[model samples]
Target: MPKVKRKTKAKSKGGIFSRFRDYISQYMTAAAAGVTVVAIGLAALFWAGGYFGLLGEQVSRMTNAGAVAMGMDVRRVTAKGLDNTQRNDILDAVGPVIGSSIFHFDPHAARARVENLGWVRVAAVSRLWPNSVHVSIRERRPAAVWQMSGTLHLIDENGVVIAEEISDAEYTNLPLIVGAGAPATANEILRALRKEPALWGAATALVRVGDRRWNMRLQKGGDVKFPETDISNAVRDLARLHDAYGILDRELEYVDLRDPENLIYREAGADETIAG
Candidate 1:
C-alpha cells in the first residue's frame, strides 16, 4: 500500500567552522585598524614633542630662562657673597651660563669656575627657582704672611697658601717664617708668641732654623732663640730678658733664650745667637 511520505528536515550548510571563519575575519580587520590608529598617534606625539622643544637643544633655552628668572644679572650678583670686582670675575668665569637656560648650564663647570678664584676656600651654589640663584661662601682667614724659599706665602690658619699677592707695606704687621715647613712652623711660632704679646707684637719675622728649631727676629733688631723642648718656657724667659735688657732698643744683637736658666746674648760683633 502507498503510504504518505514524511518531509525530512535538511541541516543548514553554515556550521561552527564557517561561523568561526567569519568571526576571525571581523577581528583581524578591527585589529589592523586599531594598530594603524596607534601608530599614527605615536608619530604625531613624537613630531609635536620635537617641534615644541621637548627634546634636544631645549637645555639651552632652559638655561637662559633660568638665568633671567633667578636674577643672575650682573648687578644683582654684587649683593651676593662676592664684591663687585669678584662678581665681575665670577661672571667672566660663568660667561657661558649668563644667558643660558638653567637646565642647560653645567652646575659643576660653574662651581669649578668660581672656586678657582683667589679667596674662595669653600664655595657652594644652588638654584632658588623661578629666577634666582643662592650662593654661600667660606673665605680663608689669613694667619700670617709666610715666607718660604725666599718667596712669600700668604697662608691661612690651616697653613694653606691662599694667595701670593704680597705687599710688604700692607702686611707689615704679619710675621715672616723661614726654613723648612714654614707654614707649620708659623703655627708653632704663633702659639709660642701668644704667651708674650709684647714680644709677638714686636716680632717682624720668624725664621725656622733646621726643621727642628725656631728663631724670631725683633722689629727693631735681635734674634730670640726658642728651645726645641719647653718652647713655652723659653718664650717666657725671653720675654723676661727683653724686659731686663730692653731688647727692643736694638742694642744687643741677639739673645739666646733656648737656655732658659742661663740666658745668653751677643752684640752685633759677637755673631753667635743660639747655643746648639
Candidate 2:
C-alpha cells in the first residue's frame, strides 16, 4: 500500500466547544439575574429598616406615613349615647392612640373593649378619617331593679344584671322586682301590664308569689294577684273592673283575679270577701 493512504476522519471540535460555551453563558445570565433580584430585595429591606427601626417599628412607621399622606391622623375622639358610663371608661377602652394615625387604629378591637363596659349594649366604632374617631353606643336601659339577697341590682329587659351596688336614686324610675327567678319573668309581666297603661303606670313592684304567679303592688295601695295561665288577659280584666267600678280605689287588702268566673276581694281590715 502506498504509505497507507487511509486518513482518519476529523472530529468536529467547534460544535462541542460552542455548545459548552452556550450552556456556560446561559448559567451566567441566570446567575446575574438572581444576584440582581437579591440585591434589590436587600436594598429595599435595608432602606425600610434603617430609615425606620426594627421590623415592627418599620411597618408601623410606614403605615403611619401612608396614613399621614392621606390625612388620617386621629385628632378627636367623639363618643355619643353616653349616659351612665363614665367618660374615662370609654377613653380607657380606646387605648393611647390619640395623636396617632387612625388608619392603623383597630375599630373592631376598640368596639369590643367598649362593649365590655357595664352600660354599653351595642357599640359602633368607626374612623372619621383625617382627624377623628367616632363611637356610637347603645346603653342598656334599666327595665327593673331586682332585689336579691337584700341587694338591689340594675337589670336590663333581658334579665341581665347591668350593675350592682348602685344607689336607688340612680334608678328611681325603674320597676322593682322581688323574689327568686323574678328577673326571668319580669319582662313578661311588665309587657302584659303595658296593655293597660293606667295599670302599668300605677304599678310599683312585682312579687313572684310561690314562683308560679305574680302579685303586683299598686302605687295607690294593696296587691293584685294574677293567675299563672292567661296572666295578660287576667290583668286586662282587672283593669276593666278598676275602670268600671273604682274597685282599686277602695280600701281593699288584695284583689284576686286567679278565677276567671269570679273575683275575690278582702276589705283592708276585714277577713275575706268574694265578688262575681
Candidate 2 has its poorest 10 consecutive residues by lDDT at 47-56
Instruction: Give the distance in Å from residue 186's predicted Cα in candidate 1 to where it truly belongs.
Output: 0.7
What are the lDDT scores of the predictions, listed in order?
0.68, 0.85
> Which stretches in model 1 have alpha-carbon errors above 4 Å?
1-79, 83-85, 93-95, 106-109, 244-250, 259-262, 269-276
Error of 1 at 232 (Å): 3.2
Task: Find the candidate with the highest lDDT and give its number.
Answer: 2
Q: How many residue pairs clash in all the candidates, one count each?
A: 11, 0
lDDT of 1 at 143: 78
In candidate 2, stretches whose alpha carbon ends up further than 4 angstroms from where it belongs are 1-73, 200-202, 219-221
Tens-place lDDT per residue, model 1, 1-276, is 999999998877778789999999999999999999999998898887785466545765666556667765332232255532266666665554444444445656667877777666766766554334455656777778877655776777777877785766656666677667778756765877877888887777888787787888876677777777787777777777668966656655777766656877776766565432
**Tens-place lDDT digits, model 2, residues 195-248:** 787776777889998878899887778899898888878887888888998777
Alpha-carbon RMSD to native, per candidate:
8.3, 6.4
For candidate 2, what's the RMSD? 6.4
